[model samples]
Target: MSTSTIVPRAKATGHHILRIRGYSHTKAVVATGEHVVSCGFRVNGRTWRIKCYPNGSTMEHADWISVALIVEPEAAAAAPVNPWFSFSILDVDGKPVPEHTSTSYGIRGFTQPGCNYGWAFHRFVRRFDLESSAHLMNDGFAIRCDIKLMRAPSLRLEETFLDVPEPDLHAHLGLLLDTGEGADVEFKVGGETFAEHRCILAARSPVFKAELSSSTAGTCVKIDDMDATAFRALLRFIYTEALPETTVPAVARQLLAVADRYQVARLRSVCEDKLSGNLDKMTTERNANSPPVRAQPRGHHGTHRWFIIIFWFMELCLKFLNLLGLRRQPPRCSLHHSMMSTSVDKPHDDEARPLISVSTIVVSQRTGHHVLRIEGYARTKMMLANGQYVCSGEFQVGGHTWHLRYYPNGHRPETASYISMHVLSTSIGATEDAVHGKVKLSLPGPGGELVPLCTYHNNHGRCTFTKQDNAISFDRYVARDELEKSSYLKDDCFSVRCDLTVFVKEVRAVSLVEVPPPVLPHHLCQLLSSQERSDVFFKVGRKTFAAHRCVLAARSSVFKAELLGPMREHEASCIRIDDMDADVFRALLHFIYTDEMPTMTSEEATTMAQHLLVAADRYDMERLKLASEDKLCRHLDTTTAATTLALAEQHQCPQLKEAVFAFLCSSTANLRAVVATDGYEHLTSSCPSISKELVAKLAAAL
Candidate 1:
């Protein structure tokens, strides 16, 4: 025999991170009381300061170093802003200083002094520790401050009314190169003539600026030594940070060399990042019958200027293939139409280009369903791919890509009890304020009654996805026994519906095109409701409320026992209720119908709130009773306080009685008027247990 275990997940509210650049000092050497501060980087238009004190802020804590991140005092005092701030030091290699420590939450909205958070580490880095550390070099240091704004940021993106022309810098530069428009210089190389803009070249490259300044040649100049093909690639990079997506691998290294020679840091980093990724995957990227980019073993540098020149010519030949528009056509290389045919020695006319990596392959879905079926429960490998515990294949919604990851045997502390799932989004080049998403996981139930097992589908329950932490997961999802039931999993198959909404800076409407409308936006309660289609009826005296048995049963166990249980009423279509007035029962029916109590004021609740509270107690409706009591407490005054106090004493609602005692004895409560009410006579006669608490409150107020 085998036993199964399920894990529940808990939700971590917010996650945040920030990357700071341009640290001035490399080695920070400070005496006691001296501190170093960082320059500001803008996020949501707020300037932040990271102050690191080598000595403590106070003389008493002199043995410790203090670190703090402060908001501009002027900005913070204008209005209270709720933000979560975190600070960290950077090592010499530009990584956050790894201090496995808890963060200080600054959620209490900032006032006059402004919002700040930090630690005065009594056992912070010792003087000797900094003196011998590799990270603390040249007196230069960097720190990052990240804020998780618990409150939503403004997402106002005003669309333009005018037909504004786009700033197409690349297209304009390409045009200049092609048509020689405003061309100030000309070059001749490898039997070809090219016209170029001297100003653009001068601004982009110091080498070009220096050469043009020293040149005596007026409109035309002869060039040698530099490969013409390399020069074309270099010119393109000057205008665009990246090459075309189809740029062949053979050309990447040559492009890097040209970028290095021109001292173009942006282009150099792009090339290096691409090369590094490809180099890492060389061994595992291909197998037999699939020709791949072979990796040369790590060793001394090969003196190979000829290979760079040859590959540059090879990439130039690809331009002709692009002109033919033969993209994605399985490579049938042809040296016959080569632009730089003489640059490299070719034994034959064909050499296959590398296949595009699978990482670029994506599935685009404006609207669709992601179905997950867990089978062979004991045999299937539960571990998720890429180090995740559980994950689904990529899916798209609302113009964003997402992947769902779940943990069945919960991660870490949550193991053996809950199920956890998270949705991760692809990083885009925008500073979005927030991304709110609602998802529902369901189990296939009889007659379209999908048992919603896991959900975070409400305004309060919105899972915010941020660029800092692209995902959110539940650590305590649900109890183990619930999922193991036969009704929850019909032969081990569970499904989920993922819905997402994202707000970006340049907000363009994402056309959903031919997708069907999703039902999740309305929630299941909408369908189960509707007076026209209810299956069961609750009759109270002369009034009746139409209801669905499934919904009532799903929300309340009491209703489930009466309607779906083995009781005689389970077979009956109508249930007659008495001892409750029509208006009071109707209000109670609304709570049963929606599982959400109505909002009430003390005067408004007076009509049926007291009777409804009694009915709620009889039917074991705790939420409705609490809601009623809360509204009554808010309305507590001399006229109503005595009545409420009597009701609380009868029902044994300690909280309500405590609220009444505190209110009636205080200056705002008017205790003399409360004592004159009709219920006060019964309160003193039937409820003598409140005398002590009442006397204590009266004494404190006096």
Candidate 2:
């Protein structure tokens, strides 16, 4: 089976600060319905402005302050613009007042004559409240507008699952071996006879193939050297490509010898790994009781002839030292320069060389992230002096406890004008050893998604944390002036995310077999195309489809209930399905058979996905439903947005509904285009509450 993936759209973000000097004078001079507009600033290659009405933009809100964000007409006319924005009133310290901050929930569209698309908060703040608050400092205040613009969505490569069955060739072969239904040969060992197929044995071993090809069909071969139990294990490995878990180390040794004689390389390797592990365990125990051995420094080497002379001299010295009770244990030398030598003493017999086996070591890392939101940023800066820090609650990552240390006034006096951040490991016994990892720090975007800051100070490569250095520090994390002027410091708060990846090492036995890829899906697809042994038939529209009842039952609970449960039709030969197109039904059958989507053009796939989503939901196929939802999300356009929104609402798909809403609300042009389509009328009639929800979302965004 095959799979497909959907990529998310890219976004460009920027912010503008509007400082109104002499606020009191503007309130008195500007009349209601009139606004004082700031110079246009560009974001995503489009110009935008902030409009503030000291006496409110309309008569109804004359006693309240009004603020709005507008897209420039020239830029809007070039193409539809979708942007998400927020407005916050800044205090004397240049920090946003929490109660005066407003954010958009989703994207808003801007088109030609962008006046109608501008978003405004009619009653942003009461005139009396602004006049009395400290924010109205020196007869003036500032407003920060943060905007995030949405670009066209594009596809990215990702791994997605297909509903293909797992490979089972070994299972089938093992079953054949156990049943012995087509046995044409026999092997006698220790007066015990075993029946087996000649072809099966010949294919697994060249020795068996040579012997079997020269014998008759019903020949009985007698094994004199090998035991019956070891022979049985060899046959099992040949058929299953694996040994039984019940195979003991003693039995494994015997099997290893037999496998080697028959050239069963995989079986021999498995036995060797098992025996090596047992030997390592025994050696560890023996060494634990003996005196500790100190490792020698590297890069020391001598000629082979000189090495032999030194080796004997050292041996004699060690023996003399032992005799004098000056040493409790004899020294074992490791010759690394010219040859690979073990610490164990060498035996006199050349044939008794120690067995060596190598284990595979896999080095990897486990990564996780945590976000620390610093509320009341201004207050924290004032309260914490240089060298003082506030720590976030402990969060676990890579099986270790960690926390973020935030120094509002900086960790050192030299960096007092900037913020300091550090990630400290707090695991018990952490000081005893070093934990190696890479660290990255970032801030959350407008949508609450972490955006990596990639600066030299924020992203530190390969840090080793030990008792000497238990934390990784970003001394100049962010300049206070830069952060105070940025959109991130909203509601007097901002968040910092720490992503840590700790390295881990693992050792395991090497595997000899290179397993083949799965073919169950291919076989199932062939069966579906052939319509072999079909137990059920469906009549959809004017076309008929043949399918296996068992396959359908296994994939969908609804199909199971309809075909095998108490609700099943009695002796019904051909069940009729209505309100579905024949092509959709055929596509559905293909997915059910092979767990893959059929190839189709982009436009056709988009349309088919909608219908298939409905069919999938009806049959309670969640994966298919999700796949369809993802397809519709990626293909959302002006023409299909309204219809897809209505479908999402009707089908109880929250994610799809949200995607449609985000697409439609991104720009006023999108809303207008969608409303001009016939689907908009159907949406309003079928899902009347959606209009209210859309308005509510827009209000929340403002």
Candidate 3:
């Protein structure tokens, strides 16, 4: 019944602020439907911008000033990005003017490309209110846009003690035997008949198969000299591959005989093992109770009875051995003579004893942690009433779905004076099966570092979560007065990070070989650096580089065609590469040799990846091109998204194209910022069809 659960952790978030000077003049010039754009800023590794309409974005709300936050155009074409944001007007002291601030109703999702509008304050502040408010100081004011970007949940692997259920083939077969719905043969043993499937009996015993093949379906086979109970037990074993737990020594002996008669080797062996175990028990008891005798007792009836039992056991053992081809014939001596001879003969001292082998199973535990931060603390308290809680976006850890539940004013009235926080598992059937983990709650320090609040530890115990009781809570997480007076609360916001460690157990068998990591790349890199026996040279932009022709040919098809084909430049001592920088060519050669990209600064890496991608495409180096595309995707910003999209389109990289479009379409502000870039003009001119596609994607999203 055990199953795997994917628990998600809380999403990480980021924020930005935009300041506008000379607000009055800017407003006078930028009428309704017109806006002022802020410089592009980075948040959560993506580009974003803020647009402020002096009046309003549209004529409908011309009396009020409007503000909007946008993501990059390329971001719009991918999966939706939901970010929680708040717009606040800051006074000269840089404190928020509470009355003029607008926290988002909830998370806003930017899901379409070329979308210029996102979460905006359409009637943010009336012109009259702005003119009278002291927050607008000296014809200038600053706007803080606190944004919490919701990142996708990441997967974490954990080793747990929970065992997945094994297959139940025997149970299914047992059920079939009990139902007798498909029974084709009937066995009549001692006037008691048992109905069973001919195929099942045939599959279990070769003698039954031979006997049944000779008879027609619906035929009843008669058995002699066998108890009906033993026959029934035999039929059960044939289907289930196991004897009933309550089987006694008497029944075992009878079953063993019948099993041997029908050629059911495994059943015969099982019955033999059971009977032998009973024999050992009886012999041990008899030895403990009786006095030792030096000679055999010929007249005693008890001795005769024990001798007969031993002889019968030996005879069955001989038959089983003969069936298994281990013995060709049975011994000729009578049981009485054999027992008498064994009693007089000395016991063999060279008999081998059983051997025991010992090995250890290695059990290891893997633990991982996820941090959840709650922003707009003050606002959340005001918005949510008692007993109401807000949940952080779902995150994944150890392949399980989880979320943080924050009760600003406590979860119940009993603890209303305190803030309550709980970590809840959203995994299916979590209540039925418990997940074990620990939690540590903390507040942000002045340096944006974590300051310990309180930890809920089981202290050698597990904090178990199940579907019915899916949460581990700190009801008195923090006193409202203590938090308000503490330095942790600032800017009407506070963050709490939950360090969660899920415990999973893994068992691994000992391995003979301790394999080391591969070093081929390191060796190849050394070879490239040594450059010994180099046969080819390339000149690019006043710099020349040396390389091995075979290595280049092996890594690049274009190089193979140029170096080994009939049109090879045999006379030329060095090849001249055009339209490429010397450094870019050097990097390309390095990749060809080592299959690894050299490290560089973030800015330099982005620029180099673009150049290397083009070179990779030209040389038909798919891996290198894909690596470059992945790098570009991570570094995509408003300024470069349009150009990157054009590059993806031209290079026939569907993945990169999709990523760029997703970024661009994520928010209207993103699209506007990208459009304003010089790259956007180039994109429109070089790939006009892309603009139409963007429009179509946006239309569909709407």
Candidate 4:
């Protein structure tokens, strides 16, 4: 007989399974009381087989046919095989026959030849049954065995799983806010007091830690410059790590100050984030109506170096006027110095019938009060003789830029002695309708007093500052005879003071999209945080919520009329709302500011939406009403269905009404309740048509 050697396959791990085909063929040669072996199959790169005895393999079981599986030439030099296997004798269709025996169990080291182990199969099948069974079809069969070895456990340095436990720190801290159970300290702010834990405050704030530990901390700490509401919000944040939107912006500045003073880093960070992220930023641009009369041009004159030069030039002019033994520099109104843009005193002229009348300068720079006083009047006097106009620094007055043109000697053909001054609107191409201002020009007298020289006042329609016409003039403004007098021109440096009052109506391009400012961190949210800082208060039953009047008026027409109308009710800046819950009002305020409905379950959201819907409808806030209506429509249940239907009927919310009808009709339980509730009666009176639909839906449900 020729033998075939089994070779190892590539890189497989664990035990190998082998099945012998036609395993029953050896039955013919298996004697009734003799040892029998079948052709082997390759297993783990080695041949293995079933060792059987037609009778018993051992004398003790001679009456039974025993079965055993063994390695043919036992793997003496190979790695140990720890295996579990099962064997089945297959029938004609390659299926295990019921009558045939199957063997399976653990085996020890099977290295040497004949070193075999297997399940003891005594009386596995009766001799008669084996001979008669299909397992021996044509005296031949197949045996299949499934064998698996536990994969070798390898030592590894890398982690196979990454799940680290984290402490639920904030949750525990949040519990401390309501229960000052271990609080050892109290604070007094305004007339109110608040309680807090000493350890927590000390841990969160270094200032608090030091102050509380000091000898003087035994007494109740009085917090000055901070209100009770703001202090309460601060304390809440300290304990809970969350800043409640109770009092803000109005309280924000105070709270920020307190946080800073306490050295509470996180509290400061929260305040900064709330203030910066959600706070309103006041714009620096001035109002456009009555522009700044003394408002100087922004670009050219803002430099300190140029201001210094202007200052020195005015000082020299004053010195020259003093030396000439003539009238001193004009009253220090504008040109002598830069008036603190807010000062608006009229130029003080000595004479009753003054030549120049100076009134309030334009308040904002956007106005047309562009005036420039050029010194060295004597130096420019030659320009008058040469028939050339002397110039003043360009200034912005009203809505247009202007510069003065002075013909020192005269504008006349003959050698005349008249001084001519003209104001030119620099923006000649501007399409502005008209710009008007009261122009006053005067000379400074001795002792810094103004000598009125020239004045012109007109309604906004006077000298136009539009594209077509741009200049206003006083030709032959003053005779050279009058100006050269000591009182008028002193030290060859007569100072001119021009006062102007202006009005400008600027037309801006109309935009179709009415883009309201971004409503966050909401100004109303800040206002809500501003408790005592608020001017308006809401008494929802007994609970009070302080708010700003501007915010209320801006949000609701009903509130505007109630708070600011001719027949107002806010005598004490308080509105009493008896029907709505305080919690619901709080939710309403939040919605007004953030436009975000409160987080609630479907049922709670629906219930609250009904009340909010009614409040919104009563307040004439269509947006809030629609928001509440939408929320109710989305979460309609039996509890809110009738009330929403009533609100929808009252507010004409067709979608919400339809949603409630559909929700009620979907279940008998809701319909039964809707019929029993008074809201349905109100709905019927308010909208009989909806009642008819509900009646039909109810009838159909029955």
Each model's lDDT: 0.53, 0.70, 0.68, 0.56
Question: Mind giving the per-residue lDDT tens digits that candidate 4 earns over 1-702?
Answer: 111222221111122222333435544555555665544444444445555676666666665566666654433436555556555665666556555645454544554434344444655555566566666654444444444434332311110111112322333444545644334577888898676655456555667768887877874788777778878877776655666767565676577678788766556555554543231121012123322333223344225323433443454565576577654344433332333223233344432231111122223324333334445676777544636786655454553456787787776656357777777665445335666666777776556566667876556434445556666767667787877765655545565666666655443321111223332223335546645236667889778888755445545667767776787775776778888898899988886555567665445676787788788887886777777776665455555566677777777877566556556655566678767877777767777787678778667644
Model 4 stretches astray by more than 4 angstroms: 1-519, 664-689, 695-702
lDDT score, candidate 3, position 92? 77
lDDT of 2 by residue, 1-702 (tens): 011111122235556678788887888889998887665455655556678889988999999989998875553248787888888988887677889999888888776573435889888888999889988877877888888777643222111122223434455556656765445678999778887765456556767867877735347898899888788888888766777878888888798679778877768767765655554444444444443443332123223223433443454565676688876443342221112345333323322322222234445578998878787899999999999997775556665667899999998989999999988885524223777778899987656566776333324457777756778889899899999998888878888988888876756533322334343455557767767546678999988888866557656778878987788874898999988899999998887756677876557888999999899899987877888887887677888888888889988888788777666656667779998999999999999999999887666544
Give one clash count per candidate, in the order shown: 22, 9, 45, 27
Candidate number of the best lDDT: 2
Error of 2 at 402 (Å): 26
Model 2 TM-score, all chains together: 0.38
Supply the TM-score for candidate 4: 0.26
Residue 665 lDDT, candidate 1, scale 0-100: 47
List residue ranges in candidate 2 displaced over 4 A: 1-356, 362-506
Backbone clashes counted, model 3: 45
Ranking by lDDT: 2, 3, 4, 1
What's the true lDDT of residue 239 in model 4? 53
lDDT of 2 at 286: 41
lDDT for position 57 in model 3? 87
What lDDT score goes with residue 407 in model 2? 96
The whole-model C-alpha lDDT of candidate 2 against the native structure comes to 0.70
